[model samples]
Target: MAETILVTGATGTVGSELVRALINRGVNTRAAVHSIIKGDRLRHFNPEVQLVEVDYHRPASLPLAFTGVDRVFLLTPFSDQQLIINQQLVDAAKAAGVQQVVRLSAAGADMEPGIQLGRWHRQMEQYLEQSGLSHVILRPTSFMQNFVNYQGQSIREQGAIYLPLGEGRMSYIDAFDIAEVAAAILTDDVAKHHGQAYTLTGPQAVNHTEIAGIIGQATGRPVQYVDVPETAARQAMQGAPQWMVDSMMELNALGKAGHLAGTTPAVEQLTGRPPRSFQEFAQEHRHELMPA
Candidate 1:
């Protein structure tokens, strides 16, 4: 019998792509989503793929999802309660005797102890290390999908990309590459990637100005990068929790200081292919960037 792999956050950017990659390779995959309603995206892969509603907050929902599962791709939503939710998955995975866990972490999670996001990921990494299950920690840099998720409408309507990252170079990675790497590790021998942490990145680091220029070239329209002041950025996020807003500002500050500009060969090392550049990402998603 083939080994079963459970993928948490199956409906998300990386998770959805990871599931597709695993299925493409003929892996017996189980996609754990929060609701059956959200499983619509994965419906095309029915029969070949199993969709299970696994709620991290509800401990009872996990064990059934883990049944017969040999490996797990653990991805927790971003929130103040991340630690609790991650712990719940770890404990359940331990109880289920899952052979391995591939966790989606963030860049600088181990190096920068001050950033709240990194700190949370680091905490989860430490817990997984002690969980006694073989694991792979993927620390990918900021995703290129952020443009489509948070600023696509602005880019289409106003031809502007606004952020608090002031002239700082960032190695924004494509989530597709991250998902490919995750699929590779999960499908390969556990011993080959176990107890390892991979800092995944794009081919090069580019500032917001360069990013805007790339989009402009791809869409044949001039797109501008608006560098907002920290105060203004904070005000824009008025209704969000104070801690979350402060974290975003601090992360942007770190980027502006050029701390997030590093690139790595991890993506190529795992997938045996060069990571996609921002220009390539823009061209591929041109329809989303171009105005209707």
Candidate 2:
């Protein structure tokens, strides 16, 4: 029998890509999505995919999603209740006899006195470690897709990228690359990756100014990076909740401090190929980042 795998956050960025990768490899894939409707994209990719509705608020749905799963790809969304949801999933996976799990974490999750985001991920990592089930943790830096997802509009309209990151560089990885690494480990020998944590990143570190230049070349436009004041950044996010605003500012501080600027070869070591570069990502997403 082929190995059966269940993916949480199946409709998300990395989760969606992982589902596609697993299907391509002919692995039996069950995608745990927030709604059956959201699984349409997965079905569009491969009609054979098994879709299960999983809502952490609805605790009973947890075990059913894990039933008969050989391995799991766990991704809890970044929210106030992230820890609680991950704990619930771990307990459910344990009860359902899951053989292993590949968890999505952040870079710097293990750092001493890190930011709230790192602290949150570290807490979950610890819980999974103590759970006794075989596990592989993937701690990836910021995604290159953030340009299209978060800053696309400004790049398109104003021909400028605005952030408080200053001259700090970050080795942002493509979510697709992260998914590829996850698929490789999930489908390969479990023993090799068991109890291991990998920090995934792109091949090089780059600052926002360099990122702006790349985007300009990719989109055939003139784009510049604007280093705004922290107060101005805070004001830009005024409509969001106070906690979320503070959280973003904390990450901004880390970026400005060059704390997020680091490169790793784990992606190449695990997948037998180098991670995607920001230039490639910008080119691929050129249409999305082009002028509106």
Model 1: lDDT equals 0.92
* lDDT against the true structure, each candidate: 0.92, 0.93
Query: Can you tell me which runs of candidate 2 are displaced by over 4 Å?
Result: none
What are the per-residue Cα lDDT tens digits for candidate 1 across 98-130?
Answer: 999999999999984569888889999999999
Over 4 Å off, model 1 = 45-47
Give the C-alpha miss distance for residue 37 in model 2, angstroms.
1.1
- Candidate 1, residue 151: Cα displacement in angstroms equals 1.1
Backbone collision count in every prediction? Answer: 0, 0
Worst 10 residues of 2 by lDDT: 37-46
* Model 1 error, position 175 (Å): 0.4
lDDT of 2: 0.93
Tens-digit per-residue lDDT, 1-292, candidate 2: 7889999999988999999999999999999998898687899779999999998899899978998999999999878999999999999999999999999999999998988888999999999999999999999999998888899999999999999999998899999999999999999888999999999999998999999999999999999999999989999998898878988899889988888888889999988889999999999999999876
Residue 239, model 1, lDDT: 100
TM-score of each: 0.98, 0.98
